[model samples]
Target: MSLTSEERAYIRSQSLARLATIGPNGPQVRPVGFVLNDDDTLDIGGPKLRESQKYRNARAHAEVALVIDDMAPADDPIAAGWGRGVEIRGRAELLTLDAPPMAPDFFSNDVIRVHPSRVISWHIAPEGQARDIV
Candidate 1:
C-alpha cells in the first residue's frame, strides 16, 4: 500500500531513523540516515555498508523495524503528552544503487529497502491515539 500524505510528510521532515536488526549475538539497533525513495522504500546508506554488521544481520534475517519520530514543538508550555512518530515493521533486503548526489562522501550508496508489512503511528489522530496502517 502507498503511504498517506501525513506519513510521507513526516518522513520527509526527518533525517535520522533507528534501524533494528537481528545480530549474531542478539537484536541490534542503530541510528541511520535514509531517503524516502519514490517507490516508498527507504534507502539507507553508510560507509562500508557491505561490511557493516547491520547488512550482515539483514542478510541472515530479513525481519526488521524502523522508527522515525521526534517531539513536536509544544504550542503550550504546560501541555504534556507523548511524542509523535511511525514504526515500520517488515522484511529488509540489500540494494546497490547509484548514490544520491547529496550523499556524504563516506557513504557507499548500498541501501536496505524495507518492505513494510505493518505500520504503527502515534499522535497522528485528532484524538492522539495510535493506529495501524497497512
Candidate 2:
C-alpha cells in the first residue's frame, strides 16, 4: 500500500492540505483540496488549476511535497507536540485534459497527480512516537 492504515485515515479525515512546488524564483506553497485516488496517488484539482503557478511549477520541477496536519490530543498531557502531522514527498505530474475523476465540488477537470515516495508522520504514535513509511 502507498499509505499505512493510520496515514490513510488521517488523509481522508482532512479536507485541506498544503502543496509545495519549486519554480525559477523559489519554492511556492499553497492550500489545495485533494483526493486520494484508488491507485495510491493524490489528485489535486480546483478552478483554473491549469493556470495556477503551482501547476506550471509541477510541470517543470516534478518533485513536490504535500503536508497535512491537524490538532489532536497528545499522549502527554502537557507536551508541546500536542498535534499530529504528516508530510508526503514525491513526484508530481500535471494532468490537463484527461485527468482523473473528481468530486462534484471540484471546480475544474485539471489535476496534479502526486505519486508519493516518502511519508513522514509525527505525533500519531500510541505515545507520540514518529515513523517513516517508504
Candidate 3:
C-alpha cells in the first residue's frame, strides 16, 4: 500500500529520517535529509550523497528501510509514553536528486529514491500502542 494523507502530512512536517540498507559490512544506517514526493515516495539526499556509503549500499542492495520520527512535544499528554513515527520498508532507486525539501546548499544532485512496499505509521498511536495507518 501507499502512504495515507495523514502519513504524508507527518512526513512533510519532518525533514530527516534514518535510512537503513545492507552493505558489505552488513546493515548500515545513517541520518538523511528527505523530501516527500507527490507520488507518495521519498527522496533521500545529502552533501556528497553520491559518495556516501548509504548511496553505495542502495546501489548494491535495493531494499531499504526509512524511519522518520520525532519525540512528542513536551506538553503532550502522552509525551512520557507515546511518540509519532513512520517506518517504511521499500525498494531503493539510486537517482538524481530533484527539488530537495531540505537545505539546498548542503545537498548534492544525488538521491536514494524509496518506493514504499510497506508502510507502518504511529502518528496517532495511543500510548505505546503502535498501529498501521494503511
Scored by TM-score, the top model is 1
Instruction: Sort by TM-score, best first.
Output: 1, 3, 2
Q: List model 1 lDDT by residue over 38-84, tens digit each.
A: 77777777888889999999999999999998887666232235588
Model 2 lDDT tens row, 20-102: 99998999999999988777789888888889999999999999999988887544443344678789999998776454355
16-132 in candidate 3: lDDT tens per residue? 899999999999989888888889888888888889899999999999999998986766654444578899999999887455456787778888889998888774444555555
Off by over 4 Å in 3: 77-81, 98-101, 125-130
CA lDDT of 11 in candidate 3?
88
TM-score for candidate 2, residues paired by index: 0.84
Per-candidate TM-scores read: 0.87, 0.84, 0.85
Model 2 alpha-carbon drift over 4 Å, by segment: 73-81, 97-106
Task: Please give the lDDT score for candidate 3.
Answer: 0.82
Clashing pairs in 2: none
For model 1, the stretches where C-alpha displacement exceeds 4 angstroms are 76-81, 100-104
C-alpha positional error of residue 129 in candidate 3 after TM-score superposition, expressed in Å: 9.7
